[model samples]
Target chain A: MRFLTLVLRSLFRSKRRTFLTVLSLSVSVFLIALLQSLLGTMDALTTSTGSGTRFVVQDKASFTNVIPQAYTNFLRQQPEVERFTVLQWFGGEYKDPKNFFANFGVDPESYLQVYREEANLPSIPLEQVRDFLRDGNGCMVGRALADKFGWKVGDVVPLKSSIFNLTVRLNIRIIFAGLRKSDEMVLAFNIKQLQEAVPWMKGRVGAITVRAKNPADIPRLCERIDHHFANSAQETLSITENAFNLNMMKLLGDYSTMVHSISAAVLVAILIVTANTMAMAIRERTTQISTMRALGFRSGQILSLLMAEGLLLSLLGSGLGIALAMGVASAAAKVAGQIIPWMADFIITPETLLLCVLITLALGLLSTFIPAYRASRRPITEGLRAL
Target chain B: MDDVSVRLRNLAKSYWRGSLEIPVLTGIDLEIPRGGYYALMGPSGSGKTTLLNLIAGIDRPSGGELEVCGHSLNGLNDDELAGWRSRNVGFIFQNYNLVPVLNAYENVELPLLLQDLGRAERRERVLHALSLVNLTDRMRNYPRQLSGGQEQRVAIARAIVHDPELIVADEPTGALDAKNAEEALILLEHLNQELGKTIVLVTHDPKAASHARFQIHLEKGVLDRTVEVHDRPVLPRLLT
Candidate 1:
């Protein structure tokens, strides 16, 4: 601790160089944190605890393909099936195409029952749920969705479907909070209204979400449901909701690898930059280091002091970067939530922050080790000659 | 301990550049007794600084026994040599090698940091050393903020702050003006006579050599001559 002032003074000896190096480091660390958190968000998508009892039944060909509504009849007959809802993505624009959010056409009462845990339906007023089930044009919007548009109960919202070439006026009925922030960025209305608008969609649905009577029965129910539609004109694929999300993620093949590669590349680049900066700083102090050696400072002591300077530099840079990542992550999550509702949960978790700290320590030690060791081990007379 | 501050027997030093041996000092035998004032006088490439560095333990000899301040430097490892130096030898360089970032007081406090002294104790010793060099008022000023002479005084304060037994100065007044050089020489005399420190100085200036009681001249890595001066001047004014 007595040598702290010396180390700090040495760091600022080249103020401009130090400032630039720190700025570059902060930016690189910020990028690393953001990319790592993105990977975390993707991982979060496929590992929700509430999804264990819920299964999604989509067309075997592709999620974009619609399956027959007649599949629900078999689901209703199954003793393991507690409730089921038919869901269709209604890709719609509010005031502008840019103001896009997740809007779905669903069987209202059944959808609420299947997603009761996620929607936190126990907290909603019973009257609001009844109002949604009674009114044909009524819709249930997530709390975040309502907040985004400054919506209130009884407010009429008009959504124009880009795919169906029609506009549907929906009365806001129940505003529901969800188990996760990402879940609260959706709006759902009755599939009956969509069928009324386009008669061709009457007996079809994008997918069916089913809740099992017991979590243990989910795997068997999936297998049985898929077997019932085997060799049919409209084949179906039934999977737990988590597996469904995982399959959706697989569509963007090896995305984790890409994110990791980019992150590794950024880290390596920053390491090189920081190493060069430290080498230059140490080189500039060759004579001063020798003077210290001549004053009876051991090689180990010299190495320790230089390493401390490097560590302090790393901590300062990464500290700023982590704070910057947090602020930007919050804002970016909101903007991304408008287009991809699940992305609203994009966050720099404590685990990510801890990983960044470990990286900072490694960067500090690795970048400064070789140069500091060389300088400290250099013969004192040779260094004195540099004077 | 022995009254002899330094003793050398057939001391030799060489450098190698990719297996080609280059001798800097060879077959040197010398001694400077305790509280003795001596100067090493030689032209460039004459090994005066090399011998001083050997005696100061900053460099090791190629082959020979070298002892300074009652410690045999040949057997000591690099770390042990550094430890021995911290407890026994002080050095004043021609370039005034004060750390540019540290002020005069902090620079003087450098050697003390290697010791197990408390903050108050270190502060007291540093202030005393600065006072001895007449730099008490300039203690807070950095090397760049001080004049060349003042910088050298700070270096001298740093050297003596630990109160070592031997003070090895390599052309300490080489970069100073005439008045500053005279003042520095007088200060060296005060340290030798009043403080009873063994002073071994290396210089090319004949006038600087004249201030020492004995002068050892080197020529081509060997001792050429030794002269004793009976009329070494003592400036009482600077001593006060």
Candidate 2:
């Protein structure tokens, strides 16, 4: 109990310096936790949601290359194919290029039939969906996009295309009838309207989102779909929805590895900076440390004192730093939501909080090691001479 | 060797600078009688502090037989020596080495911590020690808050708190002015006369040396003269 007073008083000797050290450490931890929260987005696209009953038909070569949409009609005639729909990526930006939202072209009625996740749109009137999507220029917007542009049911929005090379005017239809307005990036527009607008886009789509009667028959159904288009002008690639998402992910080229490299670099830099600050603190307290030893504190006690001091300061610093980082992340979330939607939900949880504390402790311990050993081993005579 | 508190046979301490073995206290034999006030006066490098350190068990002799209070110092390990010293020897230095972090009472209570005394018993002992030097009123005063004389008195209180049989003071009055020095000498003399403590004081001041019943002078690394001043009882010795 009495020894703890020694540790506490020692910390207060340099109020400003100690406060700064603790603050820096806290900020560093917050940044790291933010990155960890971002990791929540990593999902095995096709393998995720684990509905092996779903199958896809696309170009095995890549998502950038299209597969024949005529294949979906042929697949529907097959015995194992219960339902199928073509999903197309409409790379369109609204108002300005920076105010972009994910615009995917999918079959209006049949798309809902294949995906139960998007099946609740009927609660909103069909007349409401039609009034907005009446013309070829008219298209429905996702709830995420609707919220972003402040779009109402009757408002018409203009969007420039990156892939099809045209300005697309889409109407704000019934906002996606789901709880996840954040998943608006995944919302779909009318495929027939998109196809009629682009004549050259005939019998072509990015991929097919299919569901088979029996999950075990997915391989057989996929083989049948490929066999019919074998060596044809528009041959098809058949796969599970998970495999389809995996193939899409390959375009990004090992995203997890890249994130890991970035995170590792950040962790190392934080360790070095925090350790340096603790070293300076220990160096400044050389005389006091020696006096403590002469007063009968053993080497281990001195080590504990320094360790406790460093840890406390770093935890405080990094805690403040994390708070700052969280503020920065919150500010960034608004801008990110313009493109990504609901990005603020990516938060630092309690596990992440503990990880931050451990990081501060590790850095503090590593930094205090040399100074504590030096101070603990210093001869009393030499230390007294310094005074 | 009668009434001997310490017995040293050919005590030698050598320092090695690089390849050279420079001997400090070579082939020295000394005996200190129990319950007597004595001063060891010596010039620089005369080994007075070193000799005092050896007798107090603060440092070990390189080649010697050192026996204090019937226990051989040469054979005792560091922990055993520390324990034995706490039980029998108390040390006071020129700087009044009272732990600055602790107050006067706590400073006196330090050595008592090593003893098996409980907190209440330790408190009583510390208070009694503080009252001995008339510093009970200043019990809560830290080293910085107390005067040099008061600090030295607190230090004396600390040394005697454990009731050690022998008290070794190295340059006790070396840092004090004439007035404080006289006052400190009187307190040391009072401990010698009233409590009959065996005191080994190493100092250069003649005034401080005059208070001790026996004074030994050293030059170089050896004792040159031994002077005795009798502070005997007024009445003849009784067979109590």
Tens digit of lDDT per residue, candidate 1, span A108-148?
A: 99899888887899999999999999999999999988999
Predicted candidate 2 versus true structure: per-residue lDDT over A251-271, tens digit per residue? 678776776677688778877
**What's model 1's TM-score?**
0.95
> RMSD to native for every prediction?
2.0, 6.2
Q: What is the interface RMSD of each candidate, in Å?
A: 0.6, 4.3
Looking at candidate 2 chain B, the ten consecutive residues that score lowest on lDDT are B231-240
User: Per-residue error at A359 for model 1, in Å?
Assistant: 1.0
Q: Which stretches of candidate 1 lie over 4 Å from their true place?
A: A77-82, A212-224, A247-253
